[model samples]
Target: MFNFLKKKELHEDGTFDESGVDAGDFVDQKPLDEKESEIYTDLSIHPEWHLPEEEVYVYRFLNQELPPLQPNQVSVYGVEIKEKDGGLIVDAFVRNSLSKGIQMKPAAIIILDKQGETVARQPFDLSAVGTIPGKSSRPWTFLFPPSSIRDSEKEIPAQGWRLALELKKKPTKHSLDLSDHWKESLPQEEAQRLHQLVDSMKPPKAGEVNFFGLDARQADNGDLHVTLLIRNGSEQGLTLRQLPLRFEDRSEEVVAEGGFKLKSLTVNMNTSKPWTFIFPAESLKKTGFGFVEMEGLSSTEVMEI
Candidate 1:
């Protein structure tokens, strides 16, 4: 048995893949190691990512002494904007948190005011920024031509301005390992939203199953009505073989013990299901016990089953 209901950052950097697209827009985001092989695109450094001019810009920027970064954050800071030759020039430092080098490919440079209103938003081809080595900071410049100025009514913000990135959205990655039957009923956007929601959930450690007792109460006949949650955080699904549960009350005293045979019950990977267990009066321990201190069942342990 494991923690029942228990168990419990992608930053602005526009992620890149061999396809030269930003992976940031995808709903299902996972660490490099956990994704399915075919669907996963390694967004790390590529030899061809840096053009001759782009390489020079990154080299010069990283050479400058920079400040420390929080453990895992891709920060775009040190924004300084200027209007030159009837065009806007944005200068800022792009910081990378990954140990692997990243060559930013494409994204929008959005300027916002003090109240968080968009002053100017322009998409720029960031190939010029080139490859930003991991664990380093690089300065890149973007020039929004005069044409971009007319696109928005707000004038260029000088004093209380903030610079941000609007990474382009990529097409849906249906290659994800979700069941086709489940996706059939879901609209495209809704399906993508669910994928994002599920993917954002923090799964139990690899090969660990958490059993949580959501709620429990004593029936009039002294039987125990227990609502339990079974969580399977592993990459593979399994049908519960058996459950040997021992429920303890608020006083930490055993209140019930019953072995439940889950009839062909199945839990998919990275998902959980709820079930109600009724412990007959005979199976319950001494009464007068308060709330329960739910315990684990070895059979439900992610490692064993």
Candidate 2:
């Protein structure tokens, strides 16, 4: 209590002060791990520009292997049109960045008939946005109305139309090399087997009615609980007996009150019929197939988790 003059000075921020320490003193810093470093490096490599008040990015094609289109190359992007109730709708943005000033050009929306003849060719407005030097402007919206096409007495033989963007100047050509992600992820043999199984399990005819949906969740004991909802869509009553339900990877039979024996039940048609079944959680983790077969009815397989 008498040596009060030997007290050290305290900083207001509660941090120790080393004013006398040299600025060149070595300090150890931990290096980032491999995964952490990769993530940081990737974010800095490709920077994306955010659109004003828009959520989606504007680009002709995404995740394709083609070389980046030059500032002058013209390309079209839209969904394929099929002959249905409503005629096809085209919503695409055109991109072209050439010399300075705003360029306006007349574009053609050509529709060809089945006999290789041009049925309709309508003119549309095309504008270019000139913000960055040598950067092409992207088209906002180009619509082709369905009423513009001619209706055939028998059937419309038209396949699809192309919005040809006639360019003033031919830019440098570039080749795009697109790689498929799905092919790389799955083995060729396994992928083919999955495709075959899917092709075989086509949905019933529109008139041949059936109603079904799946309810799946994990239990407290980590087992996957799956419930099948089957509703009768027909007029007559249907009988189900000895229904064999299977889990793809699971070989164990579900224990029932009747010692694993199959039971028959009469389900009235046009009713909200329900059937409950359970499978182990491990069955879903493996790559295999599951099915349910009843007499006088087609067997159905469970594909999705």
Candidate 3:
């Protein structure tokens, strides 16, 4: 039984390969010389033996930035309006002709009277529509409630009513790898460790964001539910990934801490959008946690303000 575990094999250079080596073989084997030892040591540090998962991820976000919104990037096409249920329903198609992806907000339609005076300004929200990929088009619909089209002293013009559409520019795409096991591909906790390390560095300046109209309450499932409005007040759109959120009580102690993400998208310029953040069950330890404030973080560098 012991003899079966041993083998006598050697390379032409008189070195024993591990595949056929036994404990007793090492007694007569020659030790590797200085030159051969250095060669083997250098091969151990080859990149193929290690993964650059964290460095790849860190450099990805560090270099990923949204391009500026160019003129005529997004345009409204094939719009048709009809009256239904005492309201006006708009059937419209939007096309993104650029080579970059875009997320569209609601387009505005300005109704003008026969004399070119403004009659009613209606917002045609398009949140239900899917994202328009680069050099692609998508369809969306909007309805103007009857009450929204009424004027104090006049009805909608029968023949001279004109509609002007305003298509707001959307933010360009910023790529991030979302592959499965992306957060776990690295070894020795390097992924999380490097993420925190790079996140602490100075961030590049982009668009400005502000929060307002906060509403927080407890849901039926015992989770804390929050809804707030955010506005991008900068001249250009921004790719926003996370928002810093906290709940505090009258004593100024923290109760629950969390952040929000845009989930592979960005906000439009000068656009106000609503976001909802939910804290899981039993997250709040204090019943007096009544005050809440929210802040935004830069997507490219994870810097929070």
Candidate 4:
């Protein structure tokens, strides 16, 4: 059994320093051409292996160089893995690299096919974690083989399997804390008045949703009220289904669950609506954030305030 564990620590300033054996060093920098695909048999177990369990090969590729940065500075990028159709999907993102003092979010995607079936996927998101530092560009890659696929007993086709990579760039803003710098930026009276208004705001009514922008405010009672704007494009009514809301602490243990409801106004088809929900403040304080998931949704978007 070849068990490998990799870990990286982030500094208080939100930068990540890479320290490892250069596991990705062996991968050729040349793009993956068709000839490379021919080197490995499709869906067949490699004959040289002696281990009882399947093998997963991690490969890293340097795709491109990023713009120059100030001396001795570092940024962090992160990779996330999700399972899809018995395969793994990967996403990557870059953080703290923006010159404007904000973070830039970039994504990279990869897919793998085994035995003619799409068996693995990878999506990378840089925003999920810290970024690497200096003038060097950080390029990363990993592989999930058949042995790692949960249910491999059933044979899948070879032609159906394939691998791919896609990259995209988008704008992202990091949330700012009023106590951290907002007070200094705004007059005391205006700041206090804004704080009072937020403190007095009520929870979203049932069936009413608000799309208040990013940045979440903490109430004195230790509750978090997140407002989201919901836009309806169709002529028919949309029912908001229930999903789980989970809260975890700094240690990543679940501290609270439930207590928030999705409230939205009845939108006539082709109209837009806003909604909001309030969860226990202790939950956010413990975990930093809470998550809401509903069925038939492609993604979850959270605005800080």
Best by TM-score: 1
> How would you encode candidate 1's per-residue C-alpha lDDT over 1-305 as one tens digit per residue?
11112211112233321111223332122224322222211122334545576555444443332334443345454346777877777665666544555555566767666777766668866656666665555555667777766444456665566566665443232222334554575488955754564355455665567765656887788888886656676657768778788776655688788789977777776565556689998877686667543433233334544
Q: Write the per-residue lDDT of candidate 3 for residues 165-201, one digit (tens) a residue.
A: 5433444332122224444554647445434433443
Against the unseen true structure, what C-alpha lDDT does each candidate score?
A: 0.55, 0.34, 0.45, 0.34
lDDT for residue 290 in candidate 2, whole number 0-100: 44
TM-score of every model? 0.35, 0.26, 0.28, 0.22
Candidate 3 lands at a TM-score of 0.28
Ten residues in sequence with the least summed lDDT for candidate 4: 36-45
> Could you tell me the lDDT of residue 118 within candidate 3?
64
TM-score quality measure for candidate 2: 0.26
RMSD of each: 20.6, 28.8, 30.2, 19.4
lDDT of 4 by residue, 30-141 (tens): 2222222111101111234343432323212211212222322222232334445655433322212212222224433233444334443344353333333312333233
**Greater-lDDT candidate between 3 and 4:** 3
The list of candidate 2 runs beyond 4 A from truth reads 1-54, 58-87, 97-102, 111-120, 128-133, 137-139, 150-161, 166-305
Ranked by lDDT, the better of candidates 2 and 3 is 3
lDDT of 1: 0.55
**Deviation from native of the Cα of residue 203 in model 2, angstroms:** 66
